[model samples]
Target: MVELQARSLRVKIAQQWGSLGLPFLLVAVVILFSFLSPVFRTQFNFLSILRFASFIAISAVGMAFCIMAGEFDISVGSMMALVGVLGASFVPVIGGFAAVLTTIAISSFLGFVNGIFITKLKIPAFITTLGMMFVFRSLAYIYTDNVSVYIDNDFWLYMGNGRVLGIHFPIILMVLCFVGGYLMLRKTPFGRYVVAVGTNAKAAELSGIHVDRIKIAVFVMVGFFVGISSVVISANMGVANPGLLGQGYEFQVITAVVLGGTLLGGGNGSLGGALLAALILGSLRNGMNLMQVSSYWQQVVTGSVLIFAVAINRLRYTLMGQEA
Candidate 1:
């Protein structure tokens, strides 16, 4: 009876981890950082953290959907690089607004191509995205001749660095994206279909869920979000360097999604959790910078955190009597 009670308690904890555990962890991180550095608790610093987190969190929203739908897009980092450079190049010919729209369209088309190869060609997602990753990065380098395209458009600049009512635009964008993501995931039939497909594609197909269409849609979403992120990032930097703009971006977004309690095997996800996790990461990096931690060590710490998150996920699965 005692063992059974303990098991039940563990299951309860597992069930609530995504919604409850992540928030508490974020609070704890904030408190710890506030104590460690007097400058860390300032409103400016807090807003800065939010702005930084917004970049990863926004993409994480789409990544959550894709992973929940049982697909992965490892090419997003390269996609951002290619899209950023391409959009910046378009600024001279099409102007900023048109360039931004073109960026999104191009990225979406790339995602559609990925989906076609994965679903129609029956290629594994891993292989398809991996190949596209190399292709996209190469194209970016080729297009620029290994050069950086500088951006000077006022509208493009405002997207990432502008402020409204004293709040950073990126922060506001992040909140809006999360709200939209929440609504889409929890309040729509498409959301239900995604979950059903992720949970079991064969069963979802048997029930008429249109598994291929859902997967393709999710991939498109991944592209759409990444396109937004690319614009923001390039705006912030005022230039799009094909090689550097989105370096290691895929890892950061994936880490945020996984740490947010989205199971790698799909069927479940948490946008709130992803948002909080992104903030946590931003805070950690900011705190480490304040404390003068080495960049290499920061990478080590971030990687360790991802490993810890995966372990926790496995434990949650075990406690809930689900396969890891």
Candidate 2:
């Protein structure tokens, strides 16, 4: 009886860990970095981490939704590049606000196209997005002639570099995005439909969920968020370089989504987990940089962390009595 009780207790502990592990790990990492480097504990550095994490976290919000709908979008990196260049180029003619709107609209349209190809043509998401990735990147280069478009608009610049009451604008935007994502995921019928579709498309369709529509909407959401990030990134750098902007961004955003406890297979996800994971990644990079770690070594560390995240995800599934 005692042995059986202990086993049950262990299972309960594991279940709790599965739910709360990322936040705890984030706290532990912050504390360790604080102790290791006095600068890391400083207010400025703390805010810097938030600012840096905001870029990934904001994009991760839509990614969480996309992943929850059992879809993938690897073209986001190139999408951002294309949108950034297009948006910046439009600023002088249409003004900053209008250009921002144009950027998001174009991105949403691109995402809609992706969804149409995936759903209407019945192409696999991987192949559709993979092909789009090349197409989008090539368009950016062709349009820009391999040149960087400099951004000079005051409002456009403020999106990334502005501070309000001593807090960066991007950080505030990140918080708002997460809050909105949480509400959408936890409080709405659409959110429920997304999960239903992801969990089992056939079942969801049978229940009148319009699975294809949900998938399309989620892809559009992914594009919308990536559009926001593109604006912020170009604003921060004051230029949009076709070849350099958003390079490898898909990996980073997906890593945050997966690490935050979202299953790659779909159905289950955590917006808060993704937020914390983004902060953790930001902190890790900042701390490593402070310690003078090499860029190559940072890549190695990030890769290892991704592997560990996958292992933990499987363990969490096992602990919850689910197939991984």
Weakest lDDT window of 10 consecutive positions for candidate 2: 10-19
Q: Candidate 1 — worst ten consecutive residues by lDDT sum?
A: 16-25
Error of 1 at 90 (Å): 1.2
TM-score of each: 0.96, 0.96
Error in Å for residue 82 of model 1: 0.8
* Model 1 lDDT on a 0 to 1 scale: 0.91
C-alpha lDDT of candidate 2 relative to the true structure: 0.92
Tens digit of lDDT per residue, candidate 1, span 171-278? 998999999999999999999999999889999999988999999999999999999899998998899999998888998999999998888888977788889889
lDDT of 2 by residue, 100-165 (tens): 999989988999999999999999999999999999999999999999999999999999999999
What is residue 71's positional error in candidate 2, in angstroms?
1.0
- Which residue pairs come into collision in candidate 2? none
Give residue 186's lDDT in candidate 1 (0 to 100). Answer: 95
TM-score of 1: 0.96
Clashes of 1: 0
Model 1, residue 267: displacement in angstroms? 1.1
